[model samples]
Target: MSNSSTYTTRFPLLAKADTPAALRTVPGEHLGELAAEIRAFLVEKVCATGGHLGPNLGVVELTLALHRVFDSPRDTIIFDIGHQAYVHKLLTGRFRDFDGLRQQGGLSGYPSRTESVHDLVENSHASTALSYADGLAKARRLSSEADRDRAVVAVIGDGALTGGLAWEALNNLGAAPERPVIVVINDNGRSYAPTTGALAVHLSDLRRQADGARPESNVFIELGFAYLGPVDGHDVSAIEEALHRAQDLGRPVVVHTVTTKGKGYEPAERDEADCLHAVGAVNPATARSSIPAGQSWTSVFGSELATLAAERDDLVAITASMLRPTGLHPMQEKLPDRVFDVGIAEQHAVASAAGLAMGGFHPVVAIYATFLNRALDQVLMDVALHRLPVTFVLDRAGITGPDGPSHHGVWDPSMLSAVPGLRIAAPRDTVQLAEQLREAVAMNDGPTVLRLPKATAGPPIPSLARMDGLDILHRTRSGPLDVLLIPAGPLASAALEAAVLLEDQGLGVTVADPRWILPVNAALPAHAARHRLVVTIEDALRTGGMGTALAQACQDLAVPTPVITLGLPTAFVQQGPRAALLAEAGLDGPGIVAAVLAAHPDRRPPSAWSATTLATTPRGRDDHH
Candidate 1:
């Protein structure tokens, strides 16, 4: 039942056994000193492993104050996104294992109920803590026992405040006036980037007010909840006082604590947008370098989107507070009016895009493929039902390594394909992404989803321009085929290499990279029929994913190809390098070779394919055939 599979020994400073001595018995001045120590420890541990940095740094004081003031496990505290729970992890008996954070079989990236009693929730997605808190509060309220007096606190970021689900929870919590729900709003003025929309502006103006002079009845108050704060989040005494005040209110109350995203650290403090919201890796001396120079899918999308927006005036981009990551920063800068960052409101983002499409505008929603799950209802009902042509550029379309299971977009293709009138295209590289994006925008159809991996951009393949849909990448010389390879997207590159190794064993192999890959590729059945065995590979889950889809597709077509599908298992995957995860999942070049050669043991031919170079075009169009 564990989320991760990695384990590690404890660092002396990060040992949880020393927490009581570090703060509880120490002088009041020690809290600030301890906070500084904890921040440094977090920066060091997380920078090596790469995790939610700015968030943990920002919440150092808040987490310290919370742990000090309230008895956790008894007093339930739920972090909304849980991305900012590193501070909580450090204090509540997980300090030693923090270095193993997000690795396979190691400490989880987010708060996990299974990890510890202090960690109340295993949340990774945004804007659900309030609802969970409300439910917990209601459970306590309806308790028959007279002595159930534990408090329920939900810590949420301001970016999450813009989501409609949070508002829905607010309305419900507001209805029950006597329910004890403390909604702590950690307003740092950003969500991946500086938050957008009029509400953010209002919050900014309110924050600008001197301490006690701010308006009492704002949005949260309007919902019949007591509202407090605009308090300095870094002040341990002040934050503790605010939490005490919130608990004393005896009703659903929101405490607006304004903290800098990366407090104490000068570089993080000066960061304009997300403030190193989540760092990759950096040298201890200089916290800077990341994985070597390679164009990420986000960079390609950002650059291409800016150019696309420049050419088409009717086109408008919408993101659920992910401007920088989704590659909309350039568009946001150049066409500020056109780009709409609807805070962390994915549902609203989709519904609003539908409205734009209705008004004769070509609206493109650029969202993380995982986040897109939140807005599916809106996309289906508001956009698809209305036949509004809205282009959904799904970034991180498949296994997003290092972010863990919650952030992986493995099921996106399978989920979206189920929605009628939705056409999904899985691109192989940057050129295909650009062309497909253009095609998706130009077609005045209902809805189209473009699924691309994280940062698969490189030099375009020379034979890319003429590639067609569902074409075979490798062809045997009319020999009895031992294996037929089917790779979802760029995994085809890996399969190609595996095929070379398989050929050396005298096992005839054919590799196919279906550029316009969907769950239901008609060519797959006929293609599979030609081989003795068919193996499907994709960077997604095996259950109800691309592999399953391909299996079902082959079954439906009456193709009796004994298909051995490889994909992510029906378990939560941990965080790691892309190569590592791919190899572990048996989808990388070496892994694929191992699996293929294991399946068939016979002849040994010379290798045919070289190192795979994925083009953004269809495989059929490639002249290599």
Candidate 2:
């Protein structure tokens, strides 16, 4: 039967079922019918909401087997890369809320803690599930409840295995055999793109081996865990049988299930790139993005970097298992020799980039802002300490709406704040992205970063003047500035509109983009000295972000320009529409106006910025770090 085909009749068992508990009452014979229903439901709902459709479609039978065989909440269950947890949510009585997924005050695209008691770990970052499972199992053993009958299950994908943390947890689990835990290796064979490294090849070989007596060929057995199938993951009965065998062992065991990445949907399965991993709202009849492929920051970087690579043979590009997502395809295609895909190992990518830099090659390390957290120490010690001319291109630098808190690229700046000789730039648009990228690659003295948000790349905001690499976008008066509106990256356009709002209210505003936001450019504090109030806005944490650095600079310059920082709040921002989330965090023009007015009650704020408006998204993740 085609996955896209609708059932002739309504679901018999699943239609009225509210939760996983209801599934317990379902007859064993009805399992196949329920699985079919769930698959169809996912295809319809996910397409409407725009989410991780492919991952969920791949896990329908596995999910059914999991819920049927194991008692969740009573028996702990955790999903790494929680985007595949939609089936879990629906089984846990969230079927009605499925249509509202990824919207404000609606269903989250990933596992949300407050959403239910069944979800223990709402982790989105890959490879942390094993470590989390180990810790929980150990805690259960160490405490007075040591004798309790409970099991901890971690469903981790093969793509996540490329990370070092998984091996670290494996080593620990192997050393102590007393802890009873189940590690379900969901081997779909892709992470944004095809998964790389030695383990993937090892697992691929293991998948072809027959079950039972294959212990001699198994690596999990060597790690002090019994190895169970190369099970048919799409077959609910087989998967359940495998789980039963794992439970019977009463010790750490690996239940390897080989499944398709995008099993049901024709479009997703046929997609060679990313398997439609994460997508926007698509037509249910035909999986196509409603949003246009406008030149995003990722695209701009890809094209420009590819151009740079063509000109220079010494330039090398590296990505962490995300070639297409991070926009390295152009380079990967044009100069395959220069491109390096280090799998999901961010730590290795950064360190290897450092090695590449030392080898007389200028390495451009392209990675997601959130994922960079894994490689902080590596980048600091290996790259920054040596002050190599390695350019770190952080693609999704701010609030990545649907993927939830774990996916947001907010903490990169605050984490890298102490790294000396490190420079950071936030480009306002496509033109600046190209210019800053070229400058970063050309600079051979120290490490640099070109950070941008995950949104459409718009027109450039023309600068009225340039001082010490900073672009002065707007200035109210020459004599004494009332407010110095220092906007970071994409927020420059919005700052311009905010200036108009303040100006209409008789408050002079000077909006400038410190192109290189880090190191507190020498000209910034001097410019602030002329202003009464220095207002800084970023899409990152205001505490240690660009605003924090600027405030410290003001203190050092002995300039008493009282600074007001505006950005995202200090918390785990929930999944919603990107624009709505920004508005909620007071990063929008109206919110900026309200904050400006609240800060300066005497000056007040105009009702509107003018006929012309600026749409700015901050480069920071939160208000304070």
Candidate 3:
């Protein structure tokens, strides 16, 4: 059945409660029916489009209760790990746009400021909403507006509470006892995987206390905030009652609500691992993914790491609540004692890895490239400064699609390039990822980073030759080399295609993949001197990225070759397909051809051949990136 047709007839209650104002008007007796309908609608649309189905399904009743209790856009409701705000979106007149969820130029997977006024915080990074709520509440209290008394609610998952930022915000919010902030702890007990550390244990104890074990000294109470029940999150009326009490407090309060992660859906509830937290296109009825099984970069990394772990007793793994997602599950399953799940604390994970490395063990820290930004200080000071032999496996290293700006990892290269003693590797294929993983772990002097994209691994691009540890993928067969193409990671395919096209146009092009893209390969500047123009393509920020580093290397060597850098602009790239975003940023095969032709000395006028002219000339333009 068509989505439009299914959407129109299947959700009568959902249709009526299109907005929060309309949701407040929903009869209390029919609120249950509305929640059911919304869950059904979510399964129907989100399964087809692919999104955070499990988290959204779990929060149907909780979201409905929040809308009924607080006047949003005025009350200011912020959801930590914004993927859980799917139900909030449905309540805020976004139900009609569900069919286009996470698509290019469509509704985002997480909360988006541009999509609705209700969404104040656009960043979907976990454990940040509490801090935002704290700030917003303080702002509201000091405001002279008539509606300054409006409530500020922060609905954060128990998993998110594991993050250090949440505690930091809690410390500040609790210290200001006069501030009226409603901190709702949505205790689902999972973030991607099961929540770990002492916090989870404490929350588990709280859940036991709710079952009439004994009244213990509550942490929230000790933190200087009024504590409410460990209420049932799935019960809308019960949640609303707790919210009412919290609202009546007129001071900082904590409403601890117990809920299941994948509440309503049987498939999600039954799934042991992350409750099917995030999914691709799936069969709506069975809740089975429809995406055909393939060897993804993640799986390859996981497999290789597991193999490496079997061989080396000194190899251990650490993940910040992303054990399975970051491809550490294989190693975790094989050597359970060696793998550590540090909850949602990236900084702790990196610093702790450094500690482990200090104890004579090589700790492999598996994390998303985007999340690694949170631990930059630890990476630089704790690891790199100490010359710790820690391997950071950065998954989703480049232009990750769907999750949008905060999730796209285009800034890692720029951010980590200056970290002394840190080696960064951008693998071109699954083979390279495995090889690089092994090589990274083998290093004992300093930290190493192996970055790979979120896409499925492509066939290996065999190198024609290896020079100074660089893989020469393509070289001018029988003509003068006019352009030297340096592509980072998966962009080697596009560079190879552009090389073929440039060769056909009678311009000889040499393509090379600098396996370790950091510290500037020693042989690159010398080889680049042979070509008239050097083009560096990467799925990273153009500023201070591999391209800039390469250009700097040439300049240091007095290589007079004019360099053209093609990469994402230094801006937040929005939600879209990875390929589409790359093409838009002019990092694709045809785009590379256009960039090369525009900068080629033979194609451009003699006046344009000057270094200054080549630097200023427009090549690939992506204003959105």
Q: Quantify all predictions' global Cα lDDT against the true fold.
A: 0.76, 0.82, 0.87
In Å, residue 72's CA in model 2 sits off its true spot by: 1.1
Report residue 64 deviation for candidate 3 (angstroms).
Answer: 0.6
What clash pairs does model 3 have? none
lDDT value, residue 235 of candidate 3: 93
Residues 1-625, model 2: lDDT tens digits: 5321223235445555547788777877878778778877888888887889888888988988888889888888899878899989988978767768887678878788788988888788888999999998888888666434688899999999888898999988876778878999889888788888888898888877755355474678888988888999898889999999999988889999998987878888888987478778788778887667787889889999999999999999999999998999999999998999988889999999999999999999999999898999888899999989999999899887777778788888887777899999999988999999989999998899989799988887899888777888888764456788888899887788878877776788889899898988989889888877777888787678788888888887788777778777667777776777777666777667666665563653344532112332232222211
Candidate 3 error regions (>4 Å) = 1-6, 213-216, 604-625
**Arrange candidates by lDDT, highest first: which order?**
3, 2, 1
> What's the TM-score of each model vs. the native?
0.89, 0.93, 0.96
Of 2 and 3, the candidate ahead on TM-score is 3
**Judged by TM-score, which candidate is best?**
3
**Local accuracy of candidate 3 as per-residue lDDT tens digits, 375-435:** 9999999999999999998988889998888889888889999899899999999888888
- What's the best-to-worst order under TM-score? 3, 2, 1
Q: What CA root-mean-square deviation does each model show from the true structure?
A: 6.1, 4.1, 3.3
